[model samples]
Target: MARNIVISGASSGLGRALAIEFAGPGATLGLLGRNSERLDETAARAREKGAVVRSAAVDVRDRDAMRSFLLDFDAAAPIDCIIASAGVTMVTPVPGEVEDLTRAEELFDVNLNGAMNTIAPIAPLMRRRRAGQIVLFGSLAAFAPPPDSPSYAASKAALVAFALATRALYRADGVSVSVVCPGFVDTPMAGSYSSWKPLMMSPEDAARRIRRGLDRRKAIIAFPLPLYLAARCQQWLPDSLRTAAMLRFRAVQRLPVR
Candidate 1:
């Protein structure tokens, strides 16, 4: 197990569950999230499990702040694992309606650039030590881009590719990189979607699987065998057929009230 770990998006959903799952005696956790109160809650839970926890209410999209937070945490204790799990999702509001470009841009900023910010700062440090693990959170949508959430799917697909390339590049340095492509998870984010969610998993179960995958240094940790297979299969279908099939499951994402 990684003794010193850093996780972004640690306030809620799979990220929060992962933090709790990894917490225990001899572990040190550095957590980051946008919500201060919720981040504190996560830290408290980790502390209860006997892990030393440090938390920050910082947005992953701010590169400078993320770099500072990651570097400071690493300086205090050499980080063994870094999980870039911060992301957001949006969809076309209705059939034939294009998504707002501003919203799409914001989604990309969070899902893709934010992940880059979270990983870039500490990558070299880990390489110098010749030890570290990096995990990027992707989604099943990467395999089969959903019609309703084009930007969301594209962002995740880009992450999957980035993870693959980075994994290869860092392998020689003893730094391991893994990407997680999960199906629907019963998170508040997922709750916004009203479409049928096949094989939806609880955050705890998802976290356990992710932890196990990281322990083994697996390159890609996709879950729910059925959904994974189905997504992969969609890639081989004709473009029109694929799009039509995806339309059947189209869902509108309800933005949370501020």
Candidate 2:
């Protein structure tokens, strides 16, 4: 059967890929993004696939705007799936330099709080319907705090925790909640990193994995078996060893070019 799907950050990256994946003759898509041009491009592509597309160029950080858009979309079509895929990475601080507190807050507002803005308004509606999927985009960095990207790690970690908790709470309600923890995905967001990105997957492939996981109603959808296993093993390592190993990792320390 056709599904009513909503995707935030659908202008690019995994969000765009997922939209394309779900688009078809019977599908209805409501996509949101900050870039009007890109968002239009995505909508056009989905329309070409015979999917009914409605798109809005709006920042996820605008809670009222996000809430209104989502609520209206749900009222119109009754959402079957909602993916909170919008997020921003914080700039890695240089050695011996402290991260700017303001920048950290900005990153959190978009990455963590923005996710809440996207999911919170729709969660109850999904519960009432008793048949919908809520997918949250986290990261492998959620497994360990990267000294270089503290804010990003913290935001993703919070998502991981929140997704798990939501899954447990909503299981009986027939509302499936899932967290996707991808490693390095080859997106503009990942392009900002200056360090080696191991096992980086294309966004299409990542989206495929995510879709499969959601179809199976997985609670945690972490990807690339090798990388995921490595991250899991890090939890068992001694703190001193893990910290020393992580300290050797290097990435760009300057503010990201938005």
Candidate 3:
């Protein structure tokens, strides 16, 4: 029997790539994205790979809409895996280049709150089934304070701790949780990066790594070894020193917008 998998943010970048990678013989994919065009593209690609592709064009922040879709999915087929990849981020400076209170709220709504909405709907089903896997997208930016992308950084960082708690709560229920932290990916999301982005992997490579880690049921899957190591170094430093270092890191991206 083909296993049922749900992917949020399936319109592009890592989520799109992941949908393609997982689509193949014996896979039933329920792809969700906000954009209809891009979602169609992803579904087409998945279908080409012999997977059963279905889509729901709904914002991740809409709790009721998400629940409606998820319940429909559960009724049609049992979901075996769920990847909550729907998130938004930007390097655009707040209160300046892209200063809008509404944008800031939207960012949080999608990145953090949206994640909860994405995961919560499917979690009950997984818990009831007593078998499932959840793969959350964390980031190297999640490791440090990102003054330039305050909300984005905070969301990812918060997820790290959230995953920790989730692991404890869900492990005994036969549901495994894995949080993937990729330093930099050459995706549309990070294309605007102006500063150094080391050991960046293509979307394909990142997707492959994500599947491998999930298959192995790893608790934390951080990649591009060197960069992951670099991020981890902050843990060894004293809090005062680490805070100072983080401030410097954000300072480098402080050049005035042209």
Candidate 4:
């Protein structure tokens, strides 16, 4: 039997690169994505590297589907890790300056709720076995909402508490919950929206760092030193001041959908 790993959002970008990074003759991969063609492409790449890859075009929001899939995937082979990489930006018909609640919900469903959906299903099994890893995708935006991406900021912000919570709760079960907060990566998802992305690395580079973090069982993995520092600083800033600054910053963008 080979070491098994499951990844969501494996159709493109970081997910695709991650599949490549973990590819090997002794590894088996279970990929989840909405696009069959793109998912097939990723599977092919992983297979070329000698990995046994299988994929399903399933929406993460479908709770029952997720649960069933996780159960079956784990049963087929002992799953060593699960990575929840599927997420969408704030595309609720709103762009910059303005902010709204509808956009917030849609993006939240895919980012935060989707994250929970991904981690929860396989948790029981991992707990019973007393060993496994869960990787949650967060963002540099989690620290500060950056006016323009309000809902997007809100969406990412929801994932911050996961690292500490998971570490404290799952330790007894020997299940490690890790969060990956990358500064910015050059991906189709990132390119779809316009923004000043700093210290952006290629998906390949991001995947490599993620792999290292998972191997070491790090509780939280953040990228590109500078962005990490800025995030920390925001955490220490005054709420009132941060709010004011955000308002001023928000003024520059058009407005997000409501």
Choose the strongest candidate by lDDT: 1
Cα RMSD for candidates in order: 1.2, 1.5, 3.4, 3.2
Task: Write the residue-wise lDDT of candidate 1 on 173-199 in tens digits.
Answer: 999999999999998889876777889
Residues 1-258, candidate 2, lDDT per residue (tens digit)?
Answer: 329999999999889999999999989999999999999999999999999999998899999999999999989999999999998886556665656898889988998889999989989988997888999989988996667888889899999999999999999998989999998899888886677678899999998898889888888899898888878888889999888756655567343546
List, residue by residue over 124-166, the lDDT tens digit for candidate 3. Answer: 7898889888878888888765556776787798888888789
Clashing pairs in 1: none
User: What lDDT is obtained when candidate 3 is compared to the true structure?
Assistant: 0.81
* Each prediction's TM-score versus the true structure: 0.97, 0.96, 0.89, 0.89
Off by over 4 Å in 3: 92-101, 238-258
Superposed on all Cα atoms, model 2 deviates from the true structure by an RMSD in Å of: 1.5
